[model samples]
Target: MARPAAKARVPKHLVALAVVAILGLVLVADYLWASSSASSSAVWSSRLNLHTGPAGSTPPVAKKIKEDKKSVGSTGINATFADLPAPELKWEEMAEAPVARLDGAAIQIKNLLYVFAGYGTINHVHSHVDIYNFSDNTWGGRFDMPEDMAHSHLGMVTDGRFIYVVTGQYGPQCRGPTTRNFVLDTETKEWRGMPPLPVPRYAPATQLWRGRLHVMGGSKEDRHEPALEHWSLAVKDGKALEKEWRSEKPIPRGGPHRACVVANDKLLVIGGQEGDFMAKPGSPIFKCVRRSEVVYSNVYMLDDGTTWKELPPMPKPDSHIEFAWVNVNNSLVIAGGTTDKHPITKKMVLVGEVFRFNLGTLEWSVIGRLPFRIKTTLVGYWDGWLYFTSGQRDKGPKDPSPKKVKWVALGTVCHCHRCVVCLFF
Candidate 1:
C-alpha cells in the first residue's frame, strides 16, 4: 500500500522555473553563435587613422578607418626595438606621422624635420608636407605641396633653406613621371617650379653638390630600363639659375632607388635596383606589375663631381634606400631597404640591417638593424639618435608581404639622456 502511494506531484512553480531557465540558455546560445559568425566574416582596414600631435593633445576630428580596396595582401607581422640586431641600442617611439605614406622624403632644417609628398596608397597620393619639431618632440604645422607635384618616387634634397623636389610618378600607381620639378622654401612655405628634368626619371639619385643640383641614374619613363643619364642645375636661394639642366657624365650603373649623398665633399651613389615595379599595361585600374630586377651593392663616388670612382661595396645589395641614410661621425649610416629576391619564392627580400660606410677607412660594416625589414624609410638624425619613419614593412625573413606602417622609430647611437651606454660599431 505504501509503495502504491501516488507519485508525489511536482510543484507547479518549480516546473515553471525550470522551463524559464531552459529558454534563457537557448537564447544565450543563439546569440553567441550569431556573434561568432559575424566576427569571422568581418574584414579589417589596412590604414590606421591615428590622432597625431604632441602626446595627449585632443584630435580635431573624429577618427576614421581608411580601407584600401586594392590592398589585397596578407596582414603582416610587426617588429619592435627588441628585434634590433644591436643589443646595446634602444629605440624610442615618437609622434606618428601626420599622414601615413611611403617613398616620401624627409630633410632636417635646424630643429625641424620636414616630410613631404609621397604615396598614401597605390592609387592615393598625398600633397601635404608635415613638419616634426625635434626640439620639442612634437608634430607641428602642416602645409600643402604644389598641387601638380609628383607624389611618389621623388628625388628630394635641401640646401639650408630650400628643399628641391625632382621628377617622380605624378599621379596614381604606375603612371609615368612628370618632367616638372619643384622647390619649397622652408621659411616661406612656398613652392615654385624648378628646371624640369630633360628625361623624366623615377627616383633619381639627387643631391646638392658644389652649388649644382646633380641628378643621376633613375629608371626611365617606362619604369623598366635604367637611365645612365646625368644632369645638373645651378641652384641658389630656392631658384634655378639655369634655364635647363646641364648634361654631365653618365653613371656607370644605371638604376633607380639609389641613396645619393655628399660625404667628405664627395658625391656618392650607393645601393639600388636596375628595374622597378611597373603598371600592368591594360589593366582598368593602374595595377602594379612586378618585373625582373637586379639589386646591386655597387658603390660609386664622384670625388670631383665629374669622375665617379668605384668604392668598396655595401655588405649586401640594397635598394629603395633613397632617403634612409644620415651622417654620424663622418660615417654614412644607411638603414632598411629592399635587397635580393628570395630564391624559392622569387619575391623581393627586405633588408633590416643598419650599415655604416666609413669615409675614413673606405670600409663597410653592419652597425645595427631596423625593427623590421622596410623600404622607402625617411630618416633623420638629432642629438645622437637616428630617427626613421614611414615605409612599407615586410612580414619577415623571406616573406615579402606588404605591410603599411607609420612608426617613428629612433635608435640611440651614442650616450643617451636615458643613461644607456653607447655600443660603438
Candidate 2:
C-alpha cells in the first residue's frame, strides 16, 4: 500500500495549538452566555421597579436589588415570589377628593391625577375635571369639561397628554348616552371634538392600543341591551386619522362597567353585567328604573387584535370596576366593585376583595381585601403604592351617595417567577 501513501507526520505543537483553540472557543461561548443572562436579569429588575413607580421615576428600593439578591438564599429565604402567598393590604387614608362622584374617569399623568366628569346626585352630573396632585397630597386645579360632554358612564382613556372621553350617559339617572366624543389636551387644557361613535353606548370599554382608539362592549342606546359592537379609529397626536370609526369583531359578551385594560400587549375585558338600570319616562325624565342585572366573572382576552378569546374568569363576579385597576408586576390588581346579589338577601352586594390577575400564568387570586366595599372606584399606582378614590360606598344599591375619601394600599406587590441564583448569579 506504499506505506499508507507516506502518512504525513503530525506536528505535536500543531496538535496542541488545535486543542487550545477549541478550549478557547468553549470558554468564550460560556462567558457570552453568562453575560447575556446577567443583562436579562438586570433588565427585568428595572422593569419591575418601573411598574411600581411613575415613568422615568426610580424608587430608592431599586438600588438595593443587587444586594437583595445576594441575601435572598443565604438564610433559606424563598427567592421566587410566584408561590408566595398574597400579601394582606393595609390601607392608609389620604386627602379626600375635591368632590364625591361615581362613574367618572381618572387618569394619572406623572404625579397628577385628573378626575373627570361623573354623576353627582339624582339630577346632577359633574362637567368638570378635578386634578389631584400625588406629590403634594392635595387636590387642586379644577377645570370644566366640554360644555356638551357626557357626564356619567363616560368611557375615558389617556394617551399620557390627551384625555379621550367617549360615549356616555348624557345626563344623570337613566338618561340615554350621547355619541359625541371629545379629547382634552392636558397641556393647554383645551377640549377638542373627536369622531362620534357609530352607536351610542353607556360606559363602553375604551382603551388606546397599537396607535388605535378602541371602544367596545357597553349597553346600547336602550341602556339595557349589551352592545356587542367593537369599533376602532386610527389616531395620532390626539386627532383621529380616519374620518369615522372602523368596526371590528364583536365582543363575546356585551356589557357595561367591565374592566378594560391593555396589559402585556393584550386587551382584556373582565367582570361586567348584561342588564342595567333604565330611565323611566314620567314627570321626572331623569328617574332611573331598577332593572334586573346579571353580574359575571367572565374574562375575555384579545391578543391578535382581531379575535376575542376567553381567559380565566375572576375569582368572583365583579362589575363597575372599569377604573379600579393598577398594573403590578406581571399582574393586574383591581380594587373594590359591585358583585352579584347576595344569596340570602337577594340584593346586590359590593365587592371587598382586592383581586389579582396574573398575565404570565393566566390565573386569578384574591390577593387582598379592600378596607371597605365600593364600586366605580378610580385606581392609580404610584411610587410603590396603590391608590383609589371617589366611589360609591358600601351602602345598599339604592344609595347613590359617592365617597371622596382616598386610600393608599400598604404592602409589597411582589411576584417573582425566577429564583435569586437563576435570575442574578
Between which residue pairs do clashes occur in model 2?
none
How high a TM-score does candidate 1 get?
Answer: 0.75
The lDDT of each candidate is 0.71, 0.71
The global Cα lDDT (0 to 1) of model 2 is: 0.71
Q: Going through the candidates in order, what is the number of backbone clashes in each?
A: 0, 0
Clash pairs (backbone) in predicted model 1: none
Could you say which candidate leads in lDDT?
Answer: 1
lDDT per residue, candidate 1, 1-425, as tens digits? 36666788999999999999999999888756643432231211112111221222212221233323231112232321112233223233455555666777888887688887777667777788888776556786898888788888889899989999998888767888888999988888888998788879999999999999999999998898999999999999998999988999899999999899898888999989998888898877767788999999999988875687899999888999999888767788888888777665666677766788878889987665554466777777655455677777664432453443322122111111111011112
TM-score of each: 0.75, 0.74
